[model samples]
Target: MKIVSSEGQFQGINHNRAMEPAHQPVYEMVTRTRTRTRTIAAGLVVANLALSGLLSKADNYNGNNTPPADGGYRAEACESAKQYHYEHAGFNAPGNTGGGNSRADVNTDTNWFRFPVNFQVHMLSTNKIGATTLYKAQMDQLDVTNSNNGAIMGLDPSTNSTGATAVQTNPAGWFIESFFNLNLRQSLDGGHTYTPQPTHVVLTNHNPPVFAMAPLLPPLGGRYGGETNSKIFFCTNFSSPCCTNGIIITNVIHTGFSTNFPPPPRGSNAVHTFSSTVSFNISMDNGLSFSAASAPAVVTVSVAHRTNDLFDPDTGRTTMVLDTEMTQLDISGGTLPAGVKLRQSPAMPSDGITTILSNGPSSYMISSSFNIMPELSLDNGSTWIPTCICKRMKHIPPPDYPSTCLSNAPLGFWRLNELSGTTAFNSGSLGPTANGTDTSIVQGDPGANLTGMGANNFAYSFNTTAFVDINSSSLNLNTVTVAAWVRIPTGFLSAIVSRGTNSWRLYIDNGGHAVFQTGQGGAAASTAPVDDAQWHMLAGVYTSSTFIEQIFVDGVLAGPISSATVPGNPTIHTQIGAAPDGSQARFFGDIAQVAVFNQALTAAQIQTLRTAAGGPPSSPTPVLTISPGLGTSFDITCFFGTTVQRTYSLSSSPNWTTIGSNASPYILTVTPTTNAAFFRLVR
Candidate 1:
């Protein structure tokens, strides 16, 4: 590949510098060895000798003659190669150091090219020269007929590390040829080795100007099924004689190779050589094959151009000329034709051309230069959605059920129950801490009946003295949402979760309403009582932009109140199940499935959390009736479903203990010892 600096300087070749006046021959002839290598050496020697003899005799062997001023010599000698260089002047070649009037004044500096090849690992550390081989072949004077160009590579995300599958472009012959062969090679061991696949003729007598490959992030379903895929894009000039006349067309070929790729006979290969177009070929199976190319999507843009002043040595005349410049479109969005969606991560600028290092499924990054806003899809590439980088949040559901919310790539998440030690693991960077005593993990609440009541579960029980605290410095959220599944039997004013000094508080009010209070003096109360002795999903939202505070109970919006003021910056400790100040109003309940979001959640996200925790009850809410039974005892009767557990606390600030659990309906007699004790049912 050619390497040029932004300043128009070729890496090894000196431009605009006069050649040595000595009359030595400018071309090197390769001696044919008995080695069995027929691909490169033999072809190069013959082509170089023939061109050298013709140019040497014409230029009088001076090596310093300038192009003729009349541009007449160019028309005669420039017949073979568009990019070839002559030892002596008189022929105006594009970007030639020798004075010449050329049509294309291409920027030799800004254009940087990387050859498809692998560097020997051992040669990397030492100064020793190691053997090198082409990752993909390109046409040169040496290999005139059997040459490949426009080589690109992509990695299969699903199989990247252990034994990754790599796909690369292999176009045969020169662009000027009448027929062009489109081929590909698969490498089971990354790009260290390759196996040539079947070749297909994409165009007859047409020039495929460019080729590139990128891994297609499979749709969410494909990811679930352990499948991976990739795409290849090529721009073909459909104009007559190829490269000189018709509109440039771009098309994509998709391949799926993961083990779980869809069933065979998936889709047909698409080949269109008319008009300027952009489209993709989709593959349902992992790179095993692809479908016919989709209809082209028209993208209107002027063809790139370069201008130069050519001086013909023979005529001593200078003329202005214009030449077509090759352009590349680096795309990174997840939108494709035919309603397929692929999951995409946030746009990363370096993802436009993926390398061996950054080619994993979940870990890959993507970016674009043409203001192409990178989007991701959950269905294959059919639809697209914009996404931002979430910074500070933790959403932890039960272990067994995969969370769709988390799949959207949240800032941080931790299944509090899945954690041990003082540190709570966050999916993102910041990890919170579980501090103090009196906190213990217990049996989790039952799941929503839709998926079986006890399918996925886990919970954290907090006594009056117990609480979990996350450092305020770790998370400084302005607009925020904190949600949890909680159960409190007989609750006075209690803080379920609080951060900073009056910054935000989600708690049960003295009257048993779910209340959310923000520093902005905005307080929202749920329409229904939450401390009714059963499990309920509650969420508190504070949006600084709107200066509003809201409360949600069991997926339904309870109250949305507006206030001009917003909470003060949370610069102190953030605590769950207790006040941030360590004052009164400690929570006394069973808390499960807590999520803290850096941004205020929408109504839909809150409902999703409610469903994930355990959806709203299917039957009418059962009333807990406590009445005096026989001597010195009170009987507690309530409707029970599946496996609800009953627990009671003797003292107002006492540690609660589990009493009993049953699937059948029955009346339980509780003998109370304290004057002010509480009883509650939990699921």
Candidate 2:
């Protein structure tokens, strides 16, 4: 595919797909053998030094640095396949607009090489490409910078191939100043590399240039006798000497591609070698050329808020300012040429002025920042109707904390409090359990530290030997949801939570992918890695209705779903950070706000749970109190609406056995079979 401006000054081409090289089987085998040999040698050396009581700290590998049980492996092939080297093109300052000075802003655009395998290119006014340094999994930094200011990139939406085009302002101070001097580049190799094309002039003196492109669907009209013809939209502030006036002018450029011309050799002049034609229409009437703009005044629902603080140096104080933001675009008067009509609004509020086209000619959805709501036009902008794609749901736990919300109550919840002893109390009705010795609670993510939410204040850190066990019959449910806020600094194979009998397991594999497993079927693995030392909400859901298991990362579905039936009555005990049998590997990271819901939660409910857990802390936490009921007996009491179970043993190293369920003011009669006895409750 190739694109050029109306004046023929800018041009770009798309390269067909090319397979990335893969590692040889022999090389992989040899590497594995070598790693094994080294591991054995290191083990022997450490064993010998240990016998002499002279073991070096470097020789101790049983902790965080321990190699994987199978072998030490790196994703060299996958990393290479997705890697791309970038170069800086050189910066060009914008012309002075009548609106004063133009401030530099960092902008980013991304395209999927494939689902879950995509690259994001960033541009900065500083004239650097790849504004943020790209780092490999092994922490090696790649050299790249922004190539131009006010740069915009677009991918050919018609094909799955890695064909993309980019446009930027020229830095040469050529005819018509910076605005008219538009440059273009094309990447046929999935953004791995780029070939520059001849510069194109769109108009004289334009500021705040913006560009967007999409494949022309059937309803929007046919491509230029080819499978790929993309419509490009460019917008900018028009002025005589550049930056003199703010009249918004837009251009709709239609590009046609021809396969008759092969890609030019690297470093060759792309404009001279490429074969393509461009037709465009200029609209000084604010996007009326390609599409009609919605009326300026429309009704919209406020979805979120953006807050900023202004510092008062004189008073040594700061005043907070808030701006109400619209979630849907108002496109009351939106219209697109003969064949195109808007269909849906942007998926997110931050997405400014999203336009989606449908199959019928003249059907389109246009959302603008100032519009009250997204406007949909079915008859090619001849008519407009208000539409609401996303409906706001009521906030959970409503401000008044009504008792009617118990249906979504959690079966088990651990705040992972550092203030508490080596026992993680269940905020729910479940009883507490003895936490592993190698576990410690530390400060949690500050963004999640809501004042009233006790669990958000701290998180439990597990060494290789750490785990927490809760023995409860109520945990055996067919439909269940397990969720937690976790941060893993290093990727390792370890179970985050598992049942003793392997009925279910939520774990991270050596590849750093999150997996959800039910013994009845195969495990589901997320496409994205969650062990990047960043706080993420991980959830595994099993619903009996569909017999399907799902894994979610940060409230979004991460991977393919799996057909898995959970045991109706799984009696096995639960373990966190270790296998159910306490024999397999253990998790080495921070976990907080672990919750288990007996019922499979809907997507919205899961999102609500995440929002609530991360929201501002709530008021006074409910306390669990234990006091002497009578001699050698104790009374445990807590206000809870769910079932609570108790476990007791006669020694410090207690053999926990689940007791009968009881209400909040239950009394436990302890008969000491040994020197001392202990008791705890869990929901």
Candidate 3:
């Protein structure tokens, strides 16, 4: 809970070099088979090579040429794993081609290794790679002991010591480990067991090191659960044992590219544009130790990429800019440890590559126009939703009856960071200067700190189980009507659910107006401020036959929240920013089209749904273009020029004209008995 750590921002946005996203080539880099190597003899010797099926190697323990054996692995801690590969990948063996991997110059053969067994990296999935690659699994050199103790190096550039082993725990060597893909792949029967590519075995440090273990708890503790506490980052210089360790991973595996297109020619249409940057790094004493000095994994990393479009020869749309960065340690002071405390959790499940389009026409749209879904409000700006519908429901688990349960939120209980703001949940400001104020900008360097620094923006952490089976189902709502779309900005004072009790809210009241607070223990409260910062469509209705409780701001009728009874009871369970005293006022500013109705809308149907909020009471929001025209489609009826009573194109131009007393240009036009005729309209 020590959060609030500002100081990293690095916006650079030029992005326009565009033209290298065409990968498919790989015609034949090298595809040989039949491989084998063996030549061992002496002390405790154990050799029994067979060729029947081949694929077995096990004897790992080369920490500087093996020596610790009383159970194994400790030979002086395996010679610090060759000082963790010369401080962390600067190359010194096999084929040295150093350029920008500098840890501390050492080239003796890039030593310090170990892999008797355990290797499964896997990654692949740019939706199947069709086109678009930026993979960064970072480092690898599997040899899991035996099978001729192999060496699959790649990442050449020009070759110097490609022997692959700078050991900063295999630092970016095998050149980001052969672009990821080691998940066992079929082949293993020799010994040391086998399971490497991130196969759950860690300890790669250089000095001041301090590794411990114990925390598990999770679907296997692949990490990323309430986190607990973390901080690790190290990379200084190494050619072979320069010493200065770090590695304590609880779990780290991230991949989110927004664009890298190049694979659509058969029928044409291979669009690719990527954007991903939501960074966060940590590793305190678990994996062994990490760098950036440790203490920065508040949970970042958001990405989205997609492609698949082409009709005849049209493959346009492709613009990517997703960002996320973390690796801090420009330190100057010093004071970190005693009981060890530093946590993070505001959003991180890891997902990207959305809708590559192209299954139909040359279409593929999911840009939200470009706002990207910002509008957050963790109790600061006021209220607003739509940051992909509030992150599609980050975890789900908030309305817990009375509150008090956000230990780490996320599935086990929900509360995915509810809402916060440095902007960009779709509020614009991709970073750099659009209003991020500069701040140093470095969270990932796309627009500049897209939302990373100091507790990462402030509030927002919800999960009310993502709203659905509020305990099986009982949502009658009582006489409903609740609308949204707000933006509060100044000091952003509370209430998008100030928890009046068994809750139901819509807030904004630091004088900016807009409020809706239904009851329970707080006495059924209600407000309708409508402060006027622009996007307004606040509502609140509860007429149960005039039980009174009406307040509409943007749709007019700015009155009636005098509530004496409508507290709510379809079974409680409703929370968005929480309030009624639970603690975190959430909901800062920006929400779009929120609704809840069981029936009880009047004051002109609540100003016709606030003049159709972003659209859909008639016109634009309703699309059915043409579909019901059998026999003229039943006396055909269509209404909606502006809520001419809502109803956009009803069919039945055939017959059924009751000719009632309530008419609206009743021109009565009917014909045919069966060809298919039927039309009726009422609001």
Candidate 4:
């Protein structure tokens, strides 16, 4: 017997029905295969390399490279990009790249495509895409400079031009290891291969042949055959900090079939079908600004479940159209903080399809869409904008920090401004104008602009107004709280909030903590160390009148300074990125989602704000949410709350035994080593 129509709307699904209380489907097992490549020490090779240093003793590039005579690089989008490339990566884009699902887009020249250098991952999923596995690749940080290696230069990027090569040499002793995660779960082994399991789940890697194992599936124990999983990893080392920046990215790609499980014993009778979906979540304070986002790919999955009739089971048709409906939910503006925002737009090939499904009868498909984009925001939470809206800094360029050619620069957690008009604090009557000169410093020389990872870089004008003011009156607080997402690309840094004489403002020190300097002489009456490059949310609360300051990192209160005070009503000019105090600790990274409250928030309020941002604090005091999946036993994510801790792991099932614990984020094995487990913030 064949039939007709099917439709329904759902806020979320429940698995129960009838007289008996519905039993939630118990997770059979859980497993995770994590691949981590550490920073290896570069073996020093005594190759007396040809020297380009002007100084016979000190090795450094000549500080005076003529910047394209007249900034002539500012031609068409393509030409200017070309000059930027020559000036930075020192290479040209390849002509024709064989077009396909995995091939690079030659026409766009959008993202950097290098042979064997980048670790490309593709995923295929059966369930709506969730926070899947994270992908990473680490190499010995290599410093790029002219033949001389004397001057520290970056590739000058054209506004929104992803092709421009903007390279920045690391510090003298520090190494740069780039990292991004696989938020989407379509293909794991690389886009070239994919494996869909009977359980309707996807694996972490898509490499063909070993097609038998699923890397990111729940473990199978007392049930049928125990599950199988696999992973890959590599490491590199750099001799000096100057050339130690390497690429690490988390690929969020998913492709797969649909699978539905039987309703639990007594719960709701709602059968949940799984389909793949992609989303992004940005954070200001490490995971403090947890904001969910969608990618810009319209993926349609037409699913038809296989079923059989009881009485006429023998004669039942092979294909059964289980009553199902696939629809898109715009969760963008749903429930985030007042200063948080989100977006999900369609990708390249405009529009697609809408399907018609039937409850039971002729097999029909259920179509769905996955609309996501390079999400962007201007004001912390006032308005949401496209990634392109925040133009590239006039001086900073592409393949440098956090974006590709086709997409807008990622703020990561930092905030950026679109400089179409001019600066607010102008020195001359003519004011800040972008006329290809030192006066304006419109997008040209990397040496002139400050570039951060993703979107923290800013173009300066010697014109102080470039520093947005944040005073007691502008952002007053007797009992105040200050929060910002920052990235220090490189330097002996200091990001000032206000520069005053007697009283004062706050900032981030070179060591990565919050610093509140007050009472004249530029002394840090109150300061806390917080130096990791990843975006960190630092809250400084001057509760009551006395000089009592409590610092909170992520959700846990870091060390506090009891004698911290803002020397009473003192006038101070605010500086967002760099400290205006002649010390010149210009932030080399992005700053975003900045907020200053008049009143100090309790620990609970901060948690609520983080929850609204999408980052729910982890359990216990220090170990924040490393990784969380509903009923799974594996954990992913680095823990920063503890200065003495290395790695962390969690298990939801009592039967599941702990493998091992280390100080690194890569200790929890993703294999069936553990049964079904769920991990959450404990404290």
Candidate 5:
């Protein structure tokens, strides 16, 4: 039955039908939960923690990471990526990731061996059904950072989706939990010991939650077995938020044989499959600007990824070949041709893909799935020792926030970007919804696309008696993080996010001070006033390991409650903009981007998320221009919107005399202290 020929366009080769030739000895695929050791090929084992299914590439080192969960956004016939990594978890390369039956080289990753893109999610408790709503669940494709002309390979059709296309498919429940969180427990000491870390994966967001699981890539933390009966989850359940029925598919790939590793060695220079490195760009003036990036310190050698051929049943063989893999970027002395600067600043006003925060005068370490056990590492680009990649959260541009929330692999994160509906989708891995069905909580605020751009980003307005609730068991553990972007004009100690006063709560105190309540006897309040009629980010974090709770305002440590243990999560569900059950301490404010995590997020992660939410609306770095006035006086002009808030005021120093508030283009007549006196505008 296997007598055939392997020649030009050998019978088995079609993009649609991914199958190998019958004559040639097929390179068997191998897949196993490898820890300190990995297999290069069939029966070929190698040492060193490959970090398989952990961070970057697959074991054999293929650049393919696209899974069915990510294939819906796939484009076609594209070469270069608009940006290295869009803040949101999306991309467009060639065709869909040629997953399932074959691991081929479609448009295999090509942005160097390095890929950088964080995922952002907004929990939509209500069905997002507005004209302007992102329609995440029904998403086919939208504008990524810049590219929409590219393509992406998705899961093999062998595993049909049960929701949208049940014709010849079947989805499962593994998508939800895998999206929750993932951590790599390293054992640099030759597997003698490993990091004492436990991972609770939350692969949230529409269908096909994650692209790197099982057949996509061996589980990084190992083939996880369910907690209850000790069995690996392998089904596509559509009951959870984001994981609801949609266009995005949740292909339950079938895997049993590990004949060989995922990416078979294909090229002459391909030593091992994976290539890992960290590159950097030089920023001189703090974070204002940066020089071109150079990977002088990066220690890695590029390798060829897996390639895919097609199958044809008509001729008893196939004749079409396709590169189903997301090929790796070509590197030259650590630096690649493109990816220094992305998406012109003018292109994307809100959360533009600029080089502003991408560059640093120093090296930056990045760690995924925060608050996990993998913390320490010896990253020197020399010895491949277990190194914990850590870095201070990037400082966001003042007066603006990221288009979405900063979700560095959290248990749950609700961006609350839904324009209309009773639901704000949780963008984190957690598949829970943040329901705002309360009558007092109003959606679709006025001028949502303009004035409410940053502060709101389609935020929900909570009236005096309104509140929102969350449905999920992800937050039922010790060491938690609760953060949100809020604007409360009045100083009332109301709950911004709480599960009733008995459990934990993040709210405002008697004097506009931000507070984080751990329990009846443990609560931390900010010293200074934070409610000044503007939007501010409030974060509450409790570390069970240390039994400490902290409060942060606009990403700064406002107060820390040492030796404070968080009480057990109450039976009541989590709520936003009001107290749990909304029976007491109702809130009157605007809230957006609510993030909850089972593990305590680092100060930097919280700070990054805060800065991404416009920091403090009051502190804006408005541009001021000064020119020659009538004769002696100089005309100093700054932006003064006609809006009632943020009026402009002119003040000068001879003794610092105030010239009173005025409209934009106001000219003042004053002589110079020497030739010119410094005039400042305060709003």
Candidate 6:
């Protein structure tokens, strides 16, 4: 989630300036470490390193004084469709994702990235597993429109239990990869017409360059001899030795299981043991045209610094954007390198950071958020149940479910991305789903070239006369918060989500301002006009206890609030895309990611919602604290990342440029021509 400040749209705060956010960003610039570029010994030496412990360093690989080639990486032919057999198999592989990293020119669009992220999808709940069929997982993160910038994100599908692999076999395997010229398809009819409706499928570009291996999946299958897809596996391949190639992997995902195996417990990981490596299957070929298990002695993925995986061959720079929950990250590296930077992105995410260790092989990226206890999600992200919510859950979560899971759970979430239906599926578990009684499609941002609903990226297009109405009793509120994304054309006026007359409404009034009004008294705060046919996230919080209405636009507080106190609870049914009764000015655009919270969401929580759409915004330069040291030794500090270069010149009006990271204790001849000295860190 990045801070999205449309220039001239935000008040006071400059979206162009990267300032120290409320979520203090700290950067330690110890620019006295190592040279930025390391000239590796010529000739490609493909060698594989072992995972964990100390990584293997190829002899004569670093420091040969021979500059690395500027040619970017091009993957090799699928290196044998055969599976990788355990422990240490060195068949000419680069130590790292060979090459360097350059941030000079790279695409960060949501549609450009094809990450082969093998992640876990939890769907079955203990309550829904008995005397019936298996309940599949539903995600609100995928599907939406007008996604200008971000990454084309997705995960490889592993066998639920089919046990499919490249060995001409069928617990299945998966991979996470990147794709190009990707196509996302939709259908209106029940799987028939191409008129376009709902559900997203990544076609043609079936495989994309993989970024990282995600957390593993738990054991599948039910306890009462229900379902087969037991076991999980992942298969990967190596491309031809090129300039840039790498894939990061997180540590094992299944924890708390009584030994990665079965009696299976009454939980999600009940079918197989942790030791069972039945799912490490890969096709190296274009899909192996068709690809299982037993805890074979597998190769454990070790921590490797992938700073070598350069986006550009000519440039070698490493950059990591700071997140709200960014921990004190110690980027393990040949420190003080020229291209390494822990900088703040103009698009700052209220969510969290992606921690990368840059000292070894391929840098590993791991989410810096607190791990929540594994629980049950009956409906998308609407509700959650703790205390061992998987199957046959007699008792497995130990004492009980962690508070973290429930504390952040949503009461009702509607990711209105349906293909052909009058029903707007409430991915949440609140009450019965609200029904759209008119013609409206959950298809926005269509076409292969356009960005699809990237895991909660798209929205429901209600350009016609259609609306979603929910029963008032279902969402009766004491403490309320309503949030949703809207893209309205000029002169469009309606509610994104409304609670009835004089209640709480996040809408565009006739005045054309994005407003959040609450309390029985109808106190409201209207931000700048947003009827410019662009997407915006509006969140409204009304605390009956505080008798105040706080509104946020794009995660930042709206115009100043002058409250006229009013006390009372908000009641009445809720209607989305239109006012109650479905008449009187419908929102003439798209609406998505509508969430109704019983608890008033904090500013941080709202920021998470505001990150629904992200693109490159202007970044403010960083400010540094400089302090002169003994003699010529100088020190600098700031809440910033990136290299700090100090240039001294004997001539004024001299051409200034970044210094090369060539030597430590930087030997200066100190000729008579070198007299004047001035220093400032430029971002």
- Best lDDT goes to which candidate? 2
- The CA-based lDDT of model 1 is what? 0.36
| Candidate 5: stretches off by over 4 Å | 1-406, 432-436, 446-456, 581-584, 614-683
**Tens-digit lDDT string for candidate 6 (1-683):** 01110000001111123233322222111000012222211111111111111111111112112223542211111111111111111112122222221111111100011112111212222121112121222221211211222222221122121100001100011111100111122333322332211111110110111111121121111011101211111112122111121111111122222231111111111122232221212122222221221122111111212222212111233322221121121111222123322211113211111222132222122222211112222243244323110010010111111121123565667767655657666655464544344345556542111111244344677764667777646565657788776777764557778765555677776767777766446456665786777666677787777777787776667776535344233456678877774434777777876777878788755543332232222132233333234666644433334334555652555455554232221222222234554433444
- Which model is ahead, 3 or 4, in terms of lDDT? 4
Please tell me which model should have the higher lDDT, number 1 or number 3.
1
Every candidate's lDDT: 0.36, 0.37, 0.26, 0.27, 0.36, 0.33
By TM-score, who's the top model here?
A: 6
Q: Across residues 236-341, which tens digit of lDDT does each residue of candidate 1 receive?
A: 2312112211111112322121221111111211111112223354443423355444332222111111122223222343322111111222233334433533
Poorest stretch of ten by lDDT in candidate 4: 218-227
lDDT of 3 by residue, 107-149 (tens): 1122222223221111221211112122222223322232343
TM-score, cand. 6 vs. native: 0.37
Model 5 TM-score on a 0 to 1 scale = 0.36
List residue ranges in candidate 3 displaced over 4 A. 1-237, 241-317, 322-335, 338-683
How far in Å is the alpha carbon of 296 misplaced in model 6?
32
Q: How does residue 606 of candidate 4 score in lDDT?
A: 52
lDDT of 2 at 48: 8
Runs of candidate 6 exceeding 4 Å displacement: 1-33, 40-407, 433-458, 520-526, 562-571, 581-584, 611-683
TM-score of each: 0.34, 0.33, 0.22, 0.27, 0.36, 0.37
Per-residue lDDT for 516-626 in model 4, tens only? Answer: 655443333224455544445455556656666666664446664556555445344445654545454545544544455555567655533332222111121122223
